[model samples]
Structure formats: C-alpha cells, structure tokens
Target: MPDDPLPTHAGPFALGTFRAGRAPFPGLVTGARVRDLSDLVPSVRALVEDWDSRLPRLTALAARTDGTWHDLPDLDVLAPIEPGQILQSGANYRKHVVDLVAAEKESLHGATPEDARADAERMMDERIRSGVPYVFLGSPRAMCGPYDDIVLPALGEQHDWELELALVIGKAGRNIAEADAYDHVAAYTVCNDLTTRDRLYRPDLKAIGTDWFTAKNADTFLPTGPFLVPAAFVGDPGDLRITLRHNGIVRQDESTKDMIFDIPRLIAYVSTTTTLRPGDLLLTGSPAGNGAHWGVFLKPGDLIEAEITGLGQQRNTVRSSQA
Candidate 1:
C-alpha cells in the first residue's frame, strides 16, 4: 500500500523562536505549515503548479522525526510575521452565538428566565444584522508569539479568550475566486483572539453599534505560534478539530466542520473586498466556547493552551502589567 500515501502530504511541525542554546518555544503549529509559502513565494508557486512531484520533500523536512531537533534558547518568540493586515470574522456559528447570548444574560444582572430568552433572541438578531460574516481588523502591534505573556489593559476587566484557526496568505492576489482561494494559502496556525468583553458589549447596550475594535485590538492580544505547517500537509482545513483549555480545564471543544463560512469561502469573500497579499493573515473566527460568555476571565498566573488536530499546541502564561 505505497506507505499509506502519507496521511498528509506535508508536516506536523512546531513554530517557535530559535535561539543559540535554548529549546525552540513552540508558538503555533498546524497540520500544514502553509505560511512558509509567503516567506518563500517562488518555491511555493513552483510546488503548487506541480504538487504531486514536489510535496514529498517538503513533508520530509517538516516531519524531522530524527529526535535530533536543536535547542536554541536565546531567541524570543515573536509574531510569525509583521503581516500587512489581519482580518477576523464573527458569528460564524449560530449555535455557539445562541449559547453565548444565553450565558451572557445569565451572568449579567441576574436576569429572569424570560429575560434571558428575550436577550438571546435580540443578540442573535443583532449578530445577523451585522452580517452573516461579521468582520474586524486587529492592529499588527497586537500580535505576539507563543509563550509571550499577554498584558491586559488596566482599563479592561472583562478580558476573554477566543481560540481560532488562522490562515497565512501565500501569494498576493485580488478578487480571487473560491475555486482558486486555497491556492493562495501558504499555511494555517492557531490564534487566540483575546478581547475585553465589557468594551465589546458597551456599545451594544448603548445602541451605538461599535465595530468591536476596542474589544479585540489590545497589545499582545493575538498569540500565534508553534509552527506553520505547509499547505500540502493539510488536505482539508475545515475538517480538523480545535480545542482550548484554560489551566488544564477543557473550555472550548469542537471541529472546524462547524464553520459557517468555510476556509475557501472566507478567502474569496475577503479577496473581493481587499487584496490579500503574501504575509497577510486571516483569523477564521472562533467556536462557541470562548471565555467571554462563561464569566471566566484569565487572572494573573493563568495559563492557556490552544490546539488544533494534527497541528501542534500553543501554551502561554498570563500576567498583569502593574501600574
């Protein structure tokens, strides 16, 4: 059986900071390190045109199972790239959002059962009106590498975690077709879309319709790393499992199969609006089990672990910035 044809064509590697004499901090890892394509554009293009012939080598180097992995300690894990832009979508799961609203009502003001139901309905209606794929932008400065401590803003108290799968753009393209969208992808990674819920819901209560920017774009809010698994290794980006654990407690558990706007569709949709360039990043949205609705915010000394099936895991400790 031709070696089972290799479950995936490429990787199962870790993204980390390489230093002179320390362990590479596993920042993020995905089934495929497609993001590298952006860093090596010509090579990726060549391979894409002839994947059957070139995939094997890429897979071999990525696998690197010789147990001789080097330890480089002096390096600091930083954002994978200084991406040209970062785009994120919301409400991609109906059930998740429904559960979110219900949980929110129960935590806020101790609302009655009838009020909770009413609040959930209103929240869903608002989310729908915001659009099927609610989108937001995160500042590049907000990006951080795995193991880097996240500093919560002093003004914010409702800090939350949103575990998600992120896409790294391989080639620069505009008005890309859904059929060709995957071709533009270089790799995938895990993203923790950290936010401040109080600020996010503030405008909602005021009926002013805020854009969710303040809630998301805080310093070091986006923690991404471990490794960038090449695209050839990931046969289907939408079928993998994603899970999040806070201090060893499973909080979010679901499969990418639940995404309303699949990877291909999301790439195409974003391309129609803006040109996606090499090194650009798109966060495919988080599933339902985020900390915002659960009244579970990260406190000092807390650790978070985000993982995707086949992709490696990201572990980080949370610390507060003292005044």
Candidate 2:
C-alpha cells in the first residue's frame, strides 16, 4: 500500500481537464504531477456547478488526490470546460481599436496616418464617456487545447491570432451589478481567439460589417487552457500582461490595463443583457499589437505561443488544411 497522503492547508490550487483514453477528465495540477479526479468527478462541469462550495473540497483533495499519478506533459491537457455560451468582447482595448480606426480612416478618407491616429484617439475618449462595449458570441466547438495543433482552414489565407484574458463564471445570476461583478468569477485562463482576416467583412453587405461566424468559428480556432488559476490568486484581471509570438517573433505585447472596459463593467454589461451561468467564459478582449497591426498573417507550419500573466501558457502550431 502507498504511504498515507498529507493533509493540505489553505490552498490557491489550479485545476484543469485531461484526456483519459478517449474521454476527458478533471485533475488537480500541483508540482510536476497531475492528480487524476476520474472517480470523484464526472467532468469539469461538476466542479463549476457550485464552485464556491466545491472549491474547498477540491483544495482538500489536492493534498491527497490519489487516483493515479501522471506526468503533466505525458497527459493530454484539454480546454478546462465545454461551456455552451462563450461571450467574447471586441474593441475593448483603447490602443488596439484606435490603431484599427486610424488605419481605416487613412485608407478610406485619405487622411495622413498621424492625423487619423489623433482623431481615432479622440474618438476612443468620446466612446469611453458615452459608448458601450462590443460583445460577440463564439462557438464552444471552436475551442481547442492550449498545446494542441491549430489547423488553419483552407477557406481563408489571412488567419490571425488574438490573445486574451478569459474569465470563468462560477456563480449564476442575472443583472449583476458592476460593484458585485468580481464575486461571480471562479478562475482565470488564457485564450487565443483566432480570426480569418479576409472574411471579417462582406462586400455584398457593406452596411452589415463583420461576419463573426465566418471569421471566428473555424475548428480549433480558439486555443485555451493549459491551466485555470483560481480567481483569488489572480490579484487584478486588468493588470495582467498579454503576449503572443509567431514563429519566435514577438507580435502582440501589451497589458490588460489598456482595456476601455474593465472586467467589472464587462461582466455587468453582459449580465444585464443575458443571464451568466457557471462554466460560461467571458473574454475581456485582446490588447494592442495583432497580425493586422504588423501587416503579417499566419501561415502553415507557424508556431504560436500565447501567454498571460499567471494564467499559464498556450503553445500551438498552425497547420494548413488546403492541401
């Protein structure tokens, strides 16, 4: 018999889901090993169901999560949970949106890049005072493991990466106020919301810009979760650094402090529109510096590594499916 396991004190444990043969199972990640939770929990959904209550038990179990010990790298770490509702925020970063607006103004109105940038910066300030955040829905099926290979679809040649800080909802509620928004958070994770740049807007329907489905719903587009760090451990969501590299070249490098709308406001706004349930994911938005900013795009065999402060890292290689 194995020696008795030690008891745990107060914990800020991180949890994740792993593949058990062909099925997915939840596990506790501690040190260099993962304590399998196959017998105790059915899925990550069980843990998210009532995170406030379940967290204590999970922390305790982390002391002696003795089902089967597996080396972290040897197991297949997958997205933590398959939430039906994935709410994604867009244009929430000041520098990013300003850059985009400036580019558009210069291209369409023939303004100097300097003038356009100034006007866009002014527009951002106006919006901050009066406008609301742009929120969109993403398909759960688009989600893939952080370390898994991201297969670039053949339909579009300009596939891009948008690394973001994502929040996992724990408490279920509707019309949650901004003051109480932080209470609804369970954990924080990193996500790369991949996009197809060519299909972003339809020329046929110029008035109705942005085909989110065509641009974002490709299989394996959203690379997520090597680990889900507990919310308590994450001091402030907006202070985290978001960084991404393409083929070892630094691309996106910015902090969440540039966000026009912080997590509390985003959560409050989203909750007012629809009920936010446990297990749902809310992406705060990508910061400045994307492929669009650098005039480059993802190609076949390109490796992308996206990381956010404390949430863990996502390393994915892009594969072209055209051939």
Candidate 3:
C-alpha cells in the first residue's frame, strides 16, 4: 500500500470492502491499515445508508492506532459500495463535448474544424442555461473492483476508458433543490466508466442518439472504488482534478471545474426525475481525453491507472474474453 498519508479532512479514515480468504466484509481503512466493520454493518452500503448514526462511532474507532488491523496489501479490495441505483451524467463536461464535436468535423457538411468547435461551445453554453442535467440509469451488475481486470468482450473492438468522480448519496430526497443537494451526499469515490465505442450507436435505430446498454454496461466495465472518502473530507467537488493513464501514458487530464453543470445542479436535476436514495451513485461524467479524442483504444493486456484528487487510485489491467 502507498504510504501517502490520508488527507487531513479525510479524518484519517475511509470505507471499503475487503476479503481475507472469505466473503467480502466492510472495513474501515486508516492510512495503510484496515479494521473490519462487518460487526457494525453487513456491507459498506449499509453503513453509508445509516451514515448519520454510524459516523460518530466509526470516527471514534479511527482515532485509535491499536486494533486487529491488517496491512492493506494482505487483503483483496472489492468495489466499496453496491449502490441501489446508478445515475450517470452524460456530456456534462464542456471541453470533452467540444473536442468530440471538433474531431468529427466531417459530419458538419463542409464546415471547418473551427466552425464545429464553435458550434459545440454554443451548444454547451445553451445547455448550462437550460439548468438541467442529462442523466441515465446504469446497471449495478456492471460494476467491479477497482483493481479487477477489464474483460474485453468479443462483441466490440474499440474499448475505451473514462475516469470520473462518483458521488455516493446518503440522504434520500425527492425534487431536491440545488441549494440542498450537498446534504444528500455522504462520500465520493473514483470510477472508470468504460465504453465500447463501436457499439455506441444502433444501426437500425439511428434515431436514438446512443445505445448506452450495449456500449457501456458490459460486465466488469465500470471499475469503482478503492474506497469511499467522506464528503466532509472533500471540501469542494468542483475543484478536484481527474487524471487517467493508458499503458502508463497520461491520456485524460482535466479538472472538475470543466464540468458544464456542477454537482449540485446534477443532483437537483436527477432528483426531479426520481427520488435520490441512500447507497445510490451519481457519476458526474467524464472530462476530455477519452479514446475517441486520442484515437487510441484499449486492447488486450493494456493497463489503466486512474485517480481523482484526494480520492484513492485505481489500477486495472485489460484482458480479452478469447484469452
């Protein structure tokens, strides 16, 4: 385990699921050490759902350096929390959408690259003014451990990586206001929303912009959580930096400040559509530098490393189903 000290505001603690020759159990991670919390809660999601009442006890336990703690490397880390619903935001980053439009200038009917970019920027500005977020449902079964290998299914060849910051909802609410959105967030975690570019659209149903189920929800596609850092530990959601490396080469590097619709707005907009419940995740979308932009897609045996400022890191290796 990396010896980097936990962030000061992190209260020297985070929550995750870990296995030690048995079924996974919720554990409290303090620095390079971990202590089982399974006695208190069955799973990390259960602890998060009752976070308001459990936080104080967990905090007290974190203060002690003595316990039946285990070295982080000795255990297998699993996806921290299993959310009841996964709400994903699409095209929420300004520069990411602009670059996507700019790169596909041929679709603009004789327009120059500059014209395509300008048009995309205008569209983003209009979107922000509309005061709504584009959110879609994600299948929870698609989630896997942050360190797990991404199995490249035989269905598509153009696999890609999209590192994002995911918000873990603690409080339940309906039609929530932007001002009160933060009150519902319990913690934040790192997530990589992997996609199969070739399956992004349906040939027969071109009227539908994207086929998310085919393109995204593949098994082991969504790599999430080395651990969950409490919201209090992360001061401002919009100020964090998101970075990803493909085969040890820096690819996606951008800040959350680039998001067109901020976190509060995303939560507020999502709540209006459906009730936001505890143990639910709201992914704030990926920034620029996806495979679509770099023109390099994931292949078997490739390695990906992703991280967000303050949050923990993820290191996943890619494998092909044929292997």
CA lDDT scores, all candidates in order: 0.68, 0.85, 0.88
Q: Can you give the lDDT of residue 57 in candidate 1? A: 52
The C-alpha stretches of model 3 lying farther than 4 A from their native spots are: 1-10, 65-67
Error of 2 at 122 (Å): 1.4
Weakest ten-residue segment in model 1 by summed lDDT: 1-10
List TM-score per model, in order. 0.74, 0.93, 0.95
Q: Write the per-residue lDDT of candidate 2 for residues 1-323, one digit (tens) a residue.
A: 01212111113567889875787788887755778887888877778877999888887877875578776756778987778489999988999999899999999999999999999999999998888889999999999998888998878778888999999999998999999999999988889999999999999999999899999999999988877788988887878888899999989899899999999999999998899999999999998878888889988889898788877777887887763
Residue 139 C-alpha lDDT in model 2: 96
lDDT per residue for candidate 3 within 1-323, as digits (tens), equals 22333322255789899998878889999877899887667999999888799788888999876656887888888998999999999888999988877667747566787787898788788878975778898999899998889999899889999999999999999999999999999999999999999999898998877899989999999999889998988878899989999998999999999999999999888888899899999999999999978989999889998889878888888999888
Q: What's the best-to-worst order under lDDT?
A: 3, 2, 1
Model 1: lDDT to the true structure: 0.68
lDDT of 1 by residue, 74-103 (tens): 234445555678999887765587676676
Tell me, by TM-score, which candidate is best.
Answer: 3
Q: Tell me the TM-score of model 3.
A: 0.95
How far residue 113's Cα lies from its native spot in candidate 3, in Å, is 2.7
Stretches of model 2 off by over 4 angstroms after superposition: 1-12
Could you give me the TM-score of model 1 versus the true structure? Answer: 0.74
RMSD values for the candidates in order, in angstroms, are: 7.2, 4.6, 2.2
**Overall local distance difference test of candidate 2:** 0.85
